[model samples]
Target: MTQLSSNKASGCTGAISPVLIGAVAAALLVAALLFSASSPGRPSSAARSAKAADSEAAKRYHKDIKPILEEFCFDCHADDVKKGNLSLNEFKDDADLIAQKDRWLAVMKNVRAGVMPPPGKSRPTEAQQRQLADWVKYGAFGIDSRNPDPGRVTIHRLNRLEYRNTIAQILGVDYNTDDEFPPDGAGLGLDNIADVLTTSPLILEKYLKAAEISLDGALPSEKGREFSVQGSAFKGNNNATGDRLSFNGAPEVVFAYRNKNPGSFRVQMEIEVMAAATGTNETSTSPAASGIATNICHFVVGVQSGVAPLAVLLERDFTAEPKKHQFVFDRVWSIEPHVFKINVTAPGIRPAGRGGGGGGRGAAPPVGPQLRITNLRITAQPTAEVRRFFAKDAPPAAAKELQDYIRQGVAAFGLRAYRRPLDEPTLNRLAGEIEQRYGETGLFNDSVKPSLAKVLCSPRFLFRVTQTVPAKSGEPWSLIDEYSLASRLSYFLWSSMPDDELLNLAGKGELRKNLDGQIKRMLNHKFAARMIENFSGQWLQTRNVMKWTIVEPEVLKREGKTAGKPMLTDEIRQAMKDETTMYFARIVQEDRSLLEIIASDYTYLNEGLAGYYGIPGVQGKEMQLVKLPDDSPRGGVMTHGSVLIVTSGANRTSAVKRGVFVLD
Candidate 1:
């Protein structure tokens, strides 16, 4: 990570640069001279000439522009017609036309893109179209070149997904902000656009509550404690069935624990091993005359802290036997929470069935050895340093150390929250708040939690605030600061705050220079997959599939369902949605051509969707990539069940809707 100097040079600084001041003075002088020349009493010769020129231009508008619009546009944009709510006939003069510049701009954009004047309609000649283009470009109501306004962007608040992901990255704690916040409104097929992302009193209240919840989950508890978490609570085993646990390699079981206080912690596992079943029936009176040896189950139990990747604290193999076993793991470290995993291997042994039912009388069954975890317990005892830091009765000697620790923690957290280095005043204020809280609460964790929550709720954390740089004289646009650029890129690609590498490059002012490399790196990052769900979900309108109803008469009859409501099960709808999203992800990840979005030779499918599409060979609940035959009509997102269902009406397909979607 390269470090860059902080960007303090912004347009908002109090003192204006000499060049800008001069340019402003010149503009004022010109404006005053024009006003004086156009004063009411007596018009100068120059003013008369300008008036004559304007009249000639008005004549040209009526002759060239008005005639063309009447022929090619008025049929749709006239007063009685007003297609798209636009009445070109209302603009009688230049002022009226200029006032609605944005509408005219849209017209110009469409004309240039060749999307207007729908196919099969009488089209305007090239010469007539160019005349209209010139009228908008160089006529009296023309846009100003010197002050070309690109429009303003509304200040953006992080949406629910962004908030959750950003908090996870910054605090190393996963939070579900979606459950706490109201759904965000979308615009232009995008929910991230600032204009539609509104805030209300309820949203503000939710933010406060969410902040508190996030802080509580991230921060450690105030004191050392002991607790027991069921081993089945880990990843794999199902306690409801009470079936014997079995794994070929690493057991999916993982215990996640947060160490609030740095100290010596103990983890104990109470596991019961079942002997390998050698015969088909447990009630069999005798074994085969050959006397084959029974299979032995081996397992390696280990504890690995989250802070140290792949660092195992305890790892040993034990033979499976019919008895209870206890193992204790001890680790002394000052770090965040950790996950402990167990690995088991038993060759030539089949896994136990979900239920304890034995096989039918005639056949031999393949059963394997298994381990049953009865209990898992953990306890933490604070070290001397931790004890002193949170001591109820503080001594004078440890006061400085505790304060220093608090200051460091505050600074570090503030830097991450703000996504940049904080100014002295800001850092001091945050540190002071923590100190005050500490004075009130004597315990370190209790003191820091509230301050941390306050920081999380701050606008700096909630919004991506960019410093606006003022454009100098003759400059067409202002350049965004490096930190701002970094945030935009990260949120666009990863839907989260910039990681350390990105932030470091921004600090060194080299982010833009190395943008291509960064982009390539980010594309390969795990979070880049978010683009498929966030962007494609909206772009292809696949999210609407959840609300779509499969009401085709034949289809409804086949499925035995009523009309006017969603007949497809949630699983089928989800599978349909996944097909499009995964297709998009594959295109982006594999760097496929953009045209593949319209027509691809392959698609993703699961058993449910495959059966619906009449595609054979796919036979599982999980989705997999499959090749489409040349004659298949289901090659692109346009034909996918997700898109087809959503674009249709409750009872039948709407040709108009499908056509408009294709055009869009």
Candidate 2:
């Protein structure tokens, strides 16, 4: 018999009762035995048994099910009226659910399929359910159970777009990604719920993929001792039986030399990676972010001389995965020319590809592996610098110093309220994380720096927190935390972090305490500009004009008549954005009527957009507020190229879409 005392053996409702399981097992065994014995000889007994089972099922109200439902379902459905309806409290009798049989059926179906009451919810054991069913059949009554007490819920972090937008707002800079990240998993169809956003292995893979795709290819390159190296080996370790692999690469010693004179050298390389099924190990899901690819390798050119390696003249981590990887490092060395060594390292693992069927048993069979590299060449040296600047020294990592640096950044950018004043505990924890990663990974500075960037990019730092903290009474939540309040004010008004003035006010408890004064001061501050950029821009769909695609061939042909089909150019788009901002700024600063944006006589436009609108002789791309003539169809945001183009369909304008935009 299996002991049920260990915590692991316990059901989701906590401690399991051994007696319950024993009773359920015995009952099932006796019932099975009787059914087998009476088989063909007793049709009456079978009918009676079937009738009895139905009666038992009908008698089973939710109240009869112990501990499990109480721990899980009740938290959201019981007292919280704002959550989903259908409370388990009124389920005293089975007939009580007749009014909502559809809901009952849905619940039963979900329960049988193992989708609800959700994975993290309290799970009932099969034995427990059987025993409960039997007891209900025998006319059992509900026994009052102890209420469950799960720990307090923590806040969910921001999603990726929120992170990027917050950072861009904070820095007063543009940041975007060409690749869209996968949708985050949501509980109850809400990504903002505190408990829904989980940090899993799958989540880390998203981060890794995002880091690779978003990384800027701006590092400078160099040339020195150069050579073409090629080699290959089989998969697996230490001469153990494994799959055979054909591999080729430049010599590992190429990372030891430096370029003697300043000039440009173009080094070109290519690789090919292939996997062959040995017709054996067939049942394996393809590995993600792994296995047998030439692109996983790192290439380096060292500017070393006299074997004293004083400095690394040039270094860049480039991928050579099965395709051509090419780049030129101009004027890589500022010193005299010398023989330089070239080094290459390709790393990969072998496994089945993604979305494969399951395996039979035993160890999986190995697949044939192959990786190749060729077209190695050092073309010529550049006569001048390739990049505007380069920082060779190690960056600062101390917590206090970092805090100071952040403060300086805050001042330089003129932030309103920081989403939150990063507390000492948070800062210390982040610093510890940095030190730990540096020690464990020994990753190059470039890789290590992004870890800090990730920390800053996290939802905790980006989104304004709205957490409730209980007082020292160890009771129900009463007030929000200090950091929480800071975040709210920052994002709400400034759409960014709190500035020094606001931070000082927050420190003195004046910002939140004296609301009117802070609001007035913030209204006057430059941080208010973010409101025009983020909230107004989103509301106006200004950015969408850039990403929106118009595929209507007919419309394309029609528009292609003048200045290339009146496609919204960057110059034209900026004029529209400037027009909106200027109008909104006046609304806030000068207390002008907000309706003026839609009905004002004055409209802003640059030369490109002006000509596109048929208003001739407007020169230069600089935006200026110009008076709208009666002949001009342009006025307010309605006629702006940004709004008009985005609101249009592939072939023509969409009145419904325009109306919806206006309504929103």
Candidate 3:
């Protein structure tokens, strides 16, 4: 780990400063002015002389350049042999070649760099290469910069992370439904790329389901939710049998419950465990020590979504006589959909099956060495927030009538859902759905539920229509609408829907005013923390660092390392990730140069990361900015443990992957 973190700078570092941005903008303005000044359409004296020069260059193209091309360059680029997708013969003359300025520029750059002749076949002399580059500049294909024809903007949809983040903000709850949604397609090394985001029927279904849970959590039900174990839909067991459901040894017994609202839950169940006798008193028929084991057995009780690890609410170890035990976790906070799990593991003894009446079965369940889960009940408990927010006394949004309440509720919800102002038609359409549902059900939640699902499933919510726009007529560029700009800013910076401030500015069509100030403010916002994680995660592929098996205990064993210090512990790996993300967060919050990301004299570190990098003085788990040792060679992302871990091979560090990580 020290070696990984002590290497010199590698991957991306600090961003370009505002001053550099201003300088680049100024240079672009100058170039654009020059292009305008040398306009070929003008009938001025300058335009006439430029046209004369073009005529002379076209004449020289056949005589002077043709022989040069045939001598040293045409082997690969000639007719019927277009290596590098370049065929100089395709261009009729300088005018023809200059029409495709991008290709011409690429050809000129390669020739100028002297990488075109490719070091093998009869190479051109240094002077000839110089002459050829000059000819490209002032002779046949006189170089000119040009912007290519604009293409249609790709439509973007909120990726899974963005959707989860937006739902959390919009609904005030941490909702994780990523497993429900299909994986978002990535493009240009980013999952948020618009070109790859596409809507499908499956994703629409997931969106509707997500919206229902979000709305249900936002407007919680007072009655709460309950699930009983009898006839419950359980998996990983013998079968879906009722209270008789029991499994022996290593088999699991999972009872699932789809928690509708955000709240706490209570799990009450009776587990009957039975194991074969395996002690000094095994042969003894005495009740005191029939089959007490020396080794201890343990089990876990926790709530879960999918395969999340168990959290202990209550734990105890007992001897053989205590086969049946009651477990009641008074309250476990559960916001999203999850299942109550009771995992029991009894080691060092095989599960004893039904015995002959000779010795009689152990004082356990009918099946020996097994766990019988009976009378299981998982009930959701309403938190104080839920109790106050959805009190029956108050009407939705303070509207007196149910209809007006539904309309206001839908409108307010629409603003957050759409992340922009709703048109009259959209408002009517959404409100109409709720009103129609309310008419039939006569319940506020029932009306809101289906209508909210409708809103979430709509294309307006699924895809970003604000992004697609045509350039203004007769102009090469057009200003993005403020709403579109807001979407871009929020999604790129915050990875979520626009906040109230951005939406307010967009609504007023004034986001473009003092745009630089807004960018700075956004960079300083707390949401910018997500940008540190999301952007740097995608850029450096640091997300892969969490797959901690890259350099595990097994790696050391497999590599025949007899004895060594562990390079990474779980805490160290976690600290390594913190170091990478915190470093980027500092860059954003401190307004540091982007190049600093490539190399920096200081980095964020806690005690674990500091010792891992051989730096002293850092204390505690809380990370803080630490000045790097002068000769430490620990200056950039390339040396970070997260980066090195991702780039490492099974049993050793991958020099090839490390090099590619730096170059790529």
Give the backbone clash total of model 1. 3
Better of 1 and 2 by TM-score: 1
In what order do the candidates fall by TM-score, top score first?
Answer: 1, 3, 2
Residues 1-664, model 3: lDDT tens digits: 0000101112112222344334334543453355335322322543565577677776766777667778877888889999978887887656775466566567668767767777766766777666666666775444443412223455567788888787666655455645566778888778888768765556654554465555554554334357676524445544533333222333344666655445455677777655532322111232334453433454555666545566556565544453678878755343334665554444323334422223324533222233456577776543333333233444454324655665666776677677776777877876787677656655555455555555665555655655424555654444567887888888888888887788889888788895788888988789878988988888888877767466466676877765477767777888888889988877877788988888989888889888877898989989888898888788888778888888888667888988887787
TM-score (C-alpha) between model 1 and the true structure = 0.63
The 10 consecutive residues of candidate 2 with the worst lDDT sum are 1-10
Query: What overall lDDT goes with each candidate model?
Result: 0.65, 0.46, 0.62
Q: List candidate 3 stretches off by more than 4 Å.
A: 1-90, 94-150, 222-260, 263-393, 396-400, 439-442, 467-478, 554-567, 587-595
lDDT string for model 2 (244-282, tens) is 223232123332223322223454444444442233332
- The residue pairs that clash in candidate 1, if any, are 3-508, 4-507, 4-508
- Give the better candidate number (1 or 2) by lDDT: 1
Task: Identify the candidate with maximal TM-score.
Answer: 1
* Shift in Å, residue 204, candidate 1: 1.7
